[model samples]
Target: MTWSIVARDPETGAIGIAVASRFFAVGARVPFIAPGTGAVATQALINPLYGPRGLALLRGGAGAAEVVHALVADDSGRDHRQVQVMDARGRFAAHTGTDCVDWCGAIADDLCGLAGNMLAGPQVLEETARAFRENAALPFPRRLLVAMAAGEAAGGDKRGKQSAGLVIHGTEDWPDLDIRVDDHPEPIAELARLERVSRERWVHFKRYLATGADPVGITDRARIDSEIAAAVAAAQAQDAGEPAAGKAPAA
Candidate 1:
């Protein structure tokens, strides 16, 4: 009872997954991503091993198709599972077991894998991939959200919706954005609200965290707070179509 998208942003090298399901806490189990490595979404009967094992294989230089093949080859329960992998090279591969519920299948392109089980119909996956492709100019996280939204609009989990999640990994080992709405009547909308809230502060604050390139990230608390405030103000101004403070409006 789930549908998901796994994609890699070629320009930014960011990888992410967006998923929604009638099942509770789908976020905790379905989507897995490692920065600079790859992403996986496992559903249907839901073999949790596909997530980490797929990432390890990708890290070991396995292609997306190779990883999917290896995973299904070793699993005795492959026929009940649905999984998708997107490798670091922007290649995608997916598998939907023959025994998975009706309306279950997958679609893949160069940069994304779309899969779902017990969906409204094939249009759900089709619209998801189309939206992601059409919204190439959007920021990675927003692109994921919009894509999932389109799928939901087309008719989400045939059983109905209970939870949704969005996860993105950038250059850091940690996720750039990880938001979930577990057990909500309108889970996707709640997830979208959380995304907006995250942008207001958490996203900007994360830039100050130490990473591979910067071990001692901005230790000055005052400076960090000032920068966050400035970012928020600038965003608000931009949203209103007004010039940011200290910047002249174009004539």
Candidate 2:
């Protein structure tokens, strides 16, 4: 029903997932990630339960393998299930239920996971892992999209592609990225284009909100620095000379 990869870059603390399927809007159902938390990919007969449960386990300090074991143990339908998990610590794990459709399997690598069902062969997952591991020049989302494209080229979802998705949830100061190509003729390619445009739009919005201070019109750094210095001076002025370290100031 679905195939995906969940991964985190140890150097950047950036978590990402890439997946594709014959199903419509694969993005809407398979991948889940929280900036500082972790990532999960739930597919193969598609159990939505694993999304929140996996996240909860990771947030509670469970490692990737531990969470996968717990989830599989708890599910009576383990053989029909496929899932991949990577924690914030970059630990990785994956599962391919025995009952998954033909040509289905997964590959869990150092910092990434790849899975697929109804693929041309095991090469789908292999290509995904190879593309991700070998590409050092691309951003996280683009890397993900490239890996997915590689998977598709390697005979993805044997039934052919119908939908694709990319999701990234980060800090409040950073906008979250979520894109979907549902029922598109060439989903992965379209998804990549959408990602590029969306990223540009985000940059545009950020630029438009600039405070007219820096060369790029960002926040007024000089003014802010001056204000903070003034506040510090005022606090120092309220203090008596040579106050004891660690002692409260006299009222």
Candidate 3:
């Protein structure tokens, strides 16, 4: 019923998950990530517990393989669950339950794991992983979107698309970006639009928020507002292929 990619950005140590499913609100249950720990996607029959428990194990120094092994070890329904994990160290592991619907399986490689159940075919996961690997130059979040989009193009969830989501975490425990199209005819496109919307303001605004290193973030409202305005205008200018004011190239 779903397919997903769990990955860690080797350059920034950011970890995240991107997922889509025929099911409603797949975002609410499928993808889970801890900032400095790892990421998990649990689908197929969908064991919600695997998300938090897997992250906890990752945080406790369990490798991706150990985490998956532990999670499935005691579950009587393991044969019906599909889960994948990528640890902070770029280790990867996955499980595609034997009882999952046909066209189900998983692939794990350093820094990435891809898994799906009830998919159109093996190409879905294959293209997803391939895209992620080939687009290493893209920003982590955008790379995820591109990869998922490739999977969709290769034939996504066999039943059709409904919900899609992307989640990313930076140095902070909180997510740098978490957007979902809980139910949409074109959930991936909707998710992409939301990503653009986020770039319009939220992305720059987040810089002023409190962080672990600086509990009390920027307090000067006027300065913060000015910075945000400048950031937005600069982004707009870049989108238009023009240099921002005071940033023009020298003749």
RMSD of each: 5.6, 15.6, 5.7
Per-residue lDDT of 1-251 in model 1, one digit per residue for the tens? 99999888768888889999999899999998878988888999999889889989999999989999999999999999999888878888888999999899999877688999999999999888888887776667777787888888889899998999888899888888888888999887788778878879998999999999999887899999999999998866664742121111121
- List pairs with backbone clashes in candidate 1: none
lDDT per prediction?
Answer: 0.86, 0.74, 0.86
lDDT tens digits by residue: candidate 3, 151-211? 8888999999999999999999778999999999999878877887888889998898999
Better of 1 and 2 by lDDT: 1
Using TM-score as the yardstick, the better of models 1 and 3 is 1
What's the lDDT for residue 74 in model 1? 98
Q: lDDT by residue for model 2 over 1-251, one digit each (tens)? A: 66787776555666777677899878888987856878888888778999999999999999988989988999999999888888877777888899999898777757587878878898888877777776655557777777777777778888877998887755432335677888988888888778757643452344334342543444666665565566555545653442222111221
Q: Candidate 1, 3: how far from true, in Å?
A: 0.7
Q: Rank the candidates by TM-score, best first.
A: 1, 3, 2
TM-score (all chains, Cα) for each model:
0.93, 0.78, 0.92
Ranked by TM-score, the better of candidates 2 and 3 is 3
Q: What is the Å distance of residue 210 in model 1 from its true position?
A: 0.9
lDDT of 3: 0.86
- Model 2: worst 10 consecutive residues (lDDT sum): 242-251
User: Lowest lDDT 10-mer window, candidate 3?
Assistant: 242-251
True-structure lDDT of candidate 1: 0.86
lDDT for 175 (candidate 2): 31
